[model samples]
Target: MGSGHDTRVAVVVVTWNSAGVIEGLLRSVQGSRLDGSVRLIVVDNASSDSTVQVVRELMPDAEVLQAGRNAGYAAGMNAGMAAAGDCDSYLLLNPDIRLGPTTIQSMLEELRESGAGIVVPRLVDEFGALRLSLRREPTVLRAWGEALLGGRRAGRFPPLGEVETRAEAYDRRTEADWATGAAMLISRECLARVGAWDETYFLYSEETDFALRARDAGFALRYTPEAVAVHHEGESHESPALFSLLSRNRVKLFRSRHGAARTALFWSGVFLGELIRAARPTRRAAAWALLGNVRGVARPSS
Candidate 1:
């Protein structure tokens, strides 16, 4: 956020009742870019709390777009990007992220040099813990791999879960199918070429879909160590909700890429896995979340 030569950044953040984290995120961005003037756009996804009010107070100059209804994640982003038309680039960030120095600049540079459509930073948490936001799109096999290796056995083996800490996990710069939308920088050209986040996905997996499309459109997805940010990881508060969304969205992504038979088989395997997990509390609960989405379950909040 430091350098400036007339390239305006449309820092779009989508929030819903995020009164607790919004202020700090804005301040962090403000802190990151003391050297330039940034056009901040905060999209309020029909928050029930004082999230909108807090944003107004903390970042008065920010153009707050009120989506009176609780338009899901992709919708909020699409709205913000449409409003931010023709900017140098659009940064689709989580409301709880605090970017490191020159993170955006580094991402923009990589986007230019690598001919990439999207660029994502090394995402870390407040406690200096890393979250795996950058990833290979979740396949049913990957999901099963996660269910077996992650969640329960996370403390036992740490390496199985460093999917997002690219800077730490990989030694050199590389191309991915897509980077996480959180703390991601997309070139304006890529935006026009690949288009917006698919509205079909409410939360999870949309970026992955967009990334795959960008790749097919001949744009590489880059993960740069230089562009780093402290991601608060606030999007998934309830384990149940995240599980459901990720599971369901994974189905949609699979169907889009694969075929109906493969998709059906995937879900069938997931179903059996849930039955086997019935005796275990943590596994059973997580399994139920996966089931809820497969059964077309709707989040009461969504």
Candidate 2:
């Protein structure tokens, strides 16, 4: 690890019609306390709003890359990282996140101390409520566990679920299988070894694929509780189409890593979970989408 004065960092933010919430993130970046040089790069995914204008107006020194079209999050992240040139580390952030003054520095320190290729900070919502951001590797058993019992309930038992929801788990630094992509710091070496984010996933599960691949390459994914950030979440929770995409991507990601039989079992578990929730009006679309019954919904480019 390089000394504080010499470490170079690149901060990448991918935006899509995010003008409303992006200002806070930009201001947080501006207010960040770091010892080394930091480059700010924003990749706009053909947002119809003033997201680009807002970025330029607030962060004139930032490198803004127009993606030309509304490519997915992975594509925008790849574009921003490519435009960033070289750096010791890359901090990937969401437009709705607010960083503490020393969030970046704390993450960097944890990365150096733990020798982790990727590090994620403790995430909270705007209300200051802790978010269950950590996840274990996806497996058929875990999938069934979540399907039978809801994520929050199943997560109480480590082997029963993928998401780590125990409050005590977030009280200290520990290695994770993966975590939410809203805020993460990736070491240069890990980025080099893992290559780029898999555009195949487009948005959801892309971070999981990258983190798992890093672990496959013998790099640890560490969670540093001291480095905290506030994430306002995203549209996936409310938008049925986005939620459907997230569910579909989970199956796709699991299939890529497991055998056909296991993938089918995993798919069954995911489908059952969606099916169980289908009675609710809010979950109807995702349930239909998972069953291949929904149409006219936009899908990620293949």
Candidate 3:
């Protein structure tokens, strides 16, 4: 129902203890110039730092919604979407990302041209390294391939893997199974049809679930290198517990889509892969994380 001219985009950013990197993100958002209307919304997940205060001070126009306690990323994003009201598109961004001036404008142009429900931009690091963001849906065989051959090599061969690490199609606009959730512009129609993000995932794999569901609903997920954003990837996985939790969530996501039989096989590949990686002297921490999840190998059925 949206043409290029009369579109409205609501940018939603969910923050959790991100006072260190949020200022740059907010400033970049304020700097983005767009042809269509744009509104900024920040949802703070009860950070002990001054993340909320910084948003209020720097980006006063942005709607700041505070969750009294840490509500996790999916819940915070959902809350932000609820506060966004009516809009033709929703831009979900991580607080550590800084958008290029024309990022939103370019994405809007692509949305109108391609008619894709969800579109993501190219993500680079502070060092200007291209972070491969596109991914293939996880499967038992792909999991084994990734676990054995590594992400980069396995990604190149689709029949054997899920992570799309090849950078060939990054520069040219194309459809992808899913891209990182760091910066994505999603159409209003897709959101209404696909429904809200699965809040059950506390942190990781939420984007994958959303992307898969969107694809299932006949919506396309696209990647455009024209719109670039810098993601200061967080050190969340630096914590062994969080790493274990993330691994657990991956299984849950796989189970939700592929059923128990495939999940069991996927889990086996993951466990073997982690075990092999843990054998190295530098990966002792990973060994502990894997050992801690012995009981968590199988998630409870929903």
Candidate 4:
């Protein structure tokens, strides 16, 4: 892992019952082709399984922070960053992500050269299909349009949605409102200027909130396709609890950014969207959960 140049990086992997995938991710990190000095820190959010033990056994050199309770991803990441100390960059890596050998070097190079405060790698599935990680800022009109048109088609037409799910969209490196937090490389300068991840998000939309904050603070968010990572996605999609959290948090994020008027409109759009999706057999339960949580979705306890 030598380019004969030194760039210090602290890789923070947040885990929650991630024993099944984290070992491979850590191993991939150990075999990374970067020339930088890297510190691996695993922040586990009170995983009930053997995630902590597995991380300890497989990657003995990694610093492990045992957050005794389920603090959620944002808080867990903050804990990892607190432990990581100072570094040129902080990578908020998801436990289920496996990085390629050249991933770190390529991303770091783009970040340094492009002057972007945050840069994310191209995320693909195990079979090499692109995952739509990039996204535009959320707005009431976009939300309503997406509800009426569906994500895939709505995303293709920019005004219709916030999601950028088109495959060809990832062909070039570009600036984005936010990308998936699964494997983001954030500059220390950005962190210092914009502050830490907003813990109020609990889980979903935390990255969105952070990215928007960085942009507002004059930090650019970039998507560089040269660096690639594989993500075992769909964990949230499979869980009704997570789906409900995502639903509520989507509205929360909109409210935080646009205020009451837009939030109300966006919430209505989201409800209608869920109602439409619920018509499908597979999404019925998740749709019900989301609708149920509409009035009583608990806010993050700060």
Model number with the top lDDT: 2
Model 4, which residues run further than 4 Å from truth? 1-5, 280-302
**Cα lDDT of model 2 by residue, 141-191, tens digit:** 999999999999999998889999899999999999999999999999999
Model 4: weakest 10-residue lDDT segment is 293-302
- Which candidate do you rate higher for TM-score, 2 or 3? 2
lDDT pick, better of 3 and 4: 4
Query: Which candidate would rank higher by lDDT, 2 or 3?
Result: 2
Model 3 off-target regions past 4 Å? Answer: 1-5, 279-301
List, in order, the clash count of every candidate structure. Answer: 1, 0, 0, 0
Highest-TM-score candidate: 2
Q: Report every candidate's CA lDDT.
A: 0.72, 0.89, 0.83, 0.86
Q: Please, what are the lDDT tens digits per residue for candidate 1 over residues 1-302?
A: 45665666788999998898887888777776433346789899989999999988887888999999888888999999999865878889888778876777777778778987788887767886666665665455644544555533422333433244434454457776666677888888888999878887888878888889888888778988777788765534446456556656666676677755666665655555555666655446656766666544222212
What lDDT tens digits, residue by residue, belong to model 3 across residues 89-133? 999999999999999888988888999999999999998899888
Q: Arrange candidates by TM-score, descending.
A: 2, 4, 3, 1
What's the TM-score of every candidate structure?
A: 0.83, 0.95, 0.93, 0.94
Which pairs in model 3 have colliding backbones?
none
Worst 10 residues of 2 by lDDT: 293-302
